[model samples]
Target: MATYQIKLARSDTDAARHFTLELDSRMTVLDALFIIQREHDPSLSFRCSCRVGMCGTCAMRINWMPRLACQTRVETLNADAITIEPLAQLPVAKDLIVDLGPFFEKWKRVRPALHPKDKDSKQLAIVPPDSEFGRQAQVKRDCITCGACYSVCGITGSNSEYLGPAAINRAMLRLLDPRDGNVDDRLAVLNDETGVWRCHTQFNCVAACPKGINLTDSIMKMKRSLLFPKKFHDKQAAT
Candidate 1:
């Protein structure tokens, strides 16, 4: 057992609340939050679901870094005190829940759904795993839309109109897919001033992603695609 001092930044009053918890070293921040709410303050509001980290609903600023509360082990912090706050660059809905509306809004702008060329055909367009775009985009496809990338992004902090890393990565996935017919629409968004051009390559999103996705790479690829669209289109078509 260890004693942890949890400092929660409250949005309602723009204040901080301190709580003392005696928790197992293996316990997660989400577990501590639940204990705090149950035993300490019922009004301490936060959002969570699928405590195993699959839902990505428990993302928040833990120790000044965006992370999944459920996956952050108390022992791993190596500190007696922990600072918790809502994700930056977003409106705080309550204590730790930031409105993900802005994040999803950019996600929608990328048109994430697959618009296949032959939607009426029964055949599937399958690119082999050994293909260039397939291998490059495979690891990046695990984004759970947690907004961690958005929270840690430097561009999103200053430029709200910028399509964020997750959204851009979604666009990259579609762009690499030969079957997707809406490439022009996605490219138009990414080629805009507020699109991939806004990213400063600060790589804050890369460091903050719990899924270990290389979001910056996707942004760079899109930038290259914009410069040489025919090459990317030929590669996609060849695959």
Candidate 2:
């Protein structure tokens, strides 16, 4: 067991607070926060759910990096002191909790749901695992809406209206889905300055994604689809 210092970035209205806790080497950053809340300061604020890293609610800026608190082991940080802050590029509701409304609202603007060609059908079409649609669906469906990608997105930081990586990633998923009939509408939305054009390919979103989704690759795929419509059209016709 070792004692480590934690510096929490409080809200603008409040001064930052520091806490010291002695914890085992194997304890995660979330575990340390829990100890702080349970033992030292019940008033300390943070967000966490499904401490196993599946829910993605525990995401925060740890030591200036956007990451899931539940998955970040303290010892792996290799720092004597740790700093925790709210996710950047969004409104901070409180300590370590940013308003996800903007992030999700962008998602909605991209029309994430599958607009099936035959919605009235009682049985869904089965896509083979080896098929193009199936492979793309498998890769893109892993997003847990963590917003870690949004936090570190360069385009998002510069342009408030830009559809961040997550939204664009969702757009790519719908584009790859054979059942979705709104391809034209979705592509029209993405073919704009705030759409696929805004992405700088910084790769920060890929690094921040906890699920290991290749967000930049997805964004690039969307870019290619928009840039060379004939290629995608030829492939679609072939399929």
Candidate 3:
């Protein structure tokens, strides 16, 4: 076991505090936080659920990178100390917790819910694994709505109205789905400046996503649809 220093940025009071912990090398960042809350300061605040990567609630800025606390092992950080801060580009509700309202508002604006064109089809359609749509859907569906992509997005930081990577990624999933009926509406939403056009293609979102979703590529796909509307529309018609 070794003692390490942890600096936590507390937004509630607009200050940061340092805490020291003696932990095994195998212990995770979340484990250290738990120890701090229990032994050092019960008043310390953070959010987490599932204690696993699946629940994105534990996401924060660790060592200047967005990551799930539960998934980040202290040993892998290769440092004697670490810094913890709330997710970027969002209002910090408290220590290590940012308001998710704006993130979800943009998510809702993209219309993430599936609107099936053929609701009458009772039989389940089997999408071939080798098909283009099938492959794209599989890749895009892995997003757990962790907000890491949004946290690291530069466009979202500068443009408050800009729909971040997560929203765009969600839109891409539905856009690629053949059964979705609202493709035209989604396309219109994405065509706006605050939508796909705002992305600088910096690829920060790609790097930040813990689920490994290729967000930049997905955004580019949406941009291509806008650039060549007729081709995309015709393809949709052909399907």
Candidate 4:
């Protein structure tokens, strides 16, 4: 089996030092990390649940791309040397593990849950595939809340209060949800100076999104929704 080399941006209280590990080709970056932790460095720490990449916990910066380590193959990596580091725009608690408290806090602030117009929401007809919001939400709904977007987001780095793409995208999902109620409340939450206003229209969030969610467009939609509420009118009438 072909062998691969992995370099870690080692865990340090002050963010210094690095470690290296070499592994077999078939193993994934996450797999290699686990082996390294279990055998070589027992103190190494990181978060990973649902190794298939659905949990979003395995997300980390792998050679400049925000990817789920669990889903990335060691052999697939291009460079001879790979730099592994914790997600960006977050406080690194240890090697590869970041404090998720802040990320989730922002998520909650955006009201991630869907509140339908009526509690007795029936099996509504499908939204036309060509509709703007529907097409947009189709992409937005795929978000794993992995913090990948948050990691690469410069706006988040510059402004701690910014809701970030993941949160804004969540709000956009709610906006597209026909059954969703609480538009005013959702808008109010996003209207803060630190809310949608903080995005700065950077595409890093979209580039970093592992799920391919059009975060920039979603953010723009949310911003436009606030900028012009008339755009939110029913599609039938707009047509």
Q: What is the TM-score of each candidate against the true structure?
A: 0.95, 0.93, 0.94, 0.86
Residues 94-213 of candidate 2 have per-residue lDDT tens digits of 888899999999999989998876778777667889886788778878898989999899889989999999999898877777667677777877897789889889999998999999
lDDT (0 to 1) per candidate? 0.89, 0.86, 0.87, 0.77
Candidates sorted by TM-score, best first: 1, 3, 2, 4
TM value for model 2: 0.93
Where model 3 places Cα greater than 4 Å from the true spot, the runs are 12-16, 231-239
Mark the 10 consecutive residues where model 2 has the least summed lDDT: 230-239
Off by over 4 Å in 4: 12-22, 121-126, 231-239
Could you tell me how far off, in angstroms, the CA of residue 206 lies in candidate 1 after the best superposition? 0.4
Candidate 4 lDDT by residue in tens digits, 41-113: 7777878999987888899988878889998887888655777889888888878888877788889987789
- Residues 83-145 of candidate 3: C-alpha lDDT, one tens digit per residue: 988899888888888899999999999899988778797867567877757898888788888
What is residue 207's positional error in candidate 4, in angstroms? 1.2
Clashes of each: 0, 0, 0, 0
**What is the Cα root-mean-square deviation between model 3 and the actual structure?**
1.7
Better model by lDDT: candidate 3 vs candidate 4: 3
List clashing residue pairs in candidate 4: none
Candidate 1 TM-score over all chains jointly? 0.95
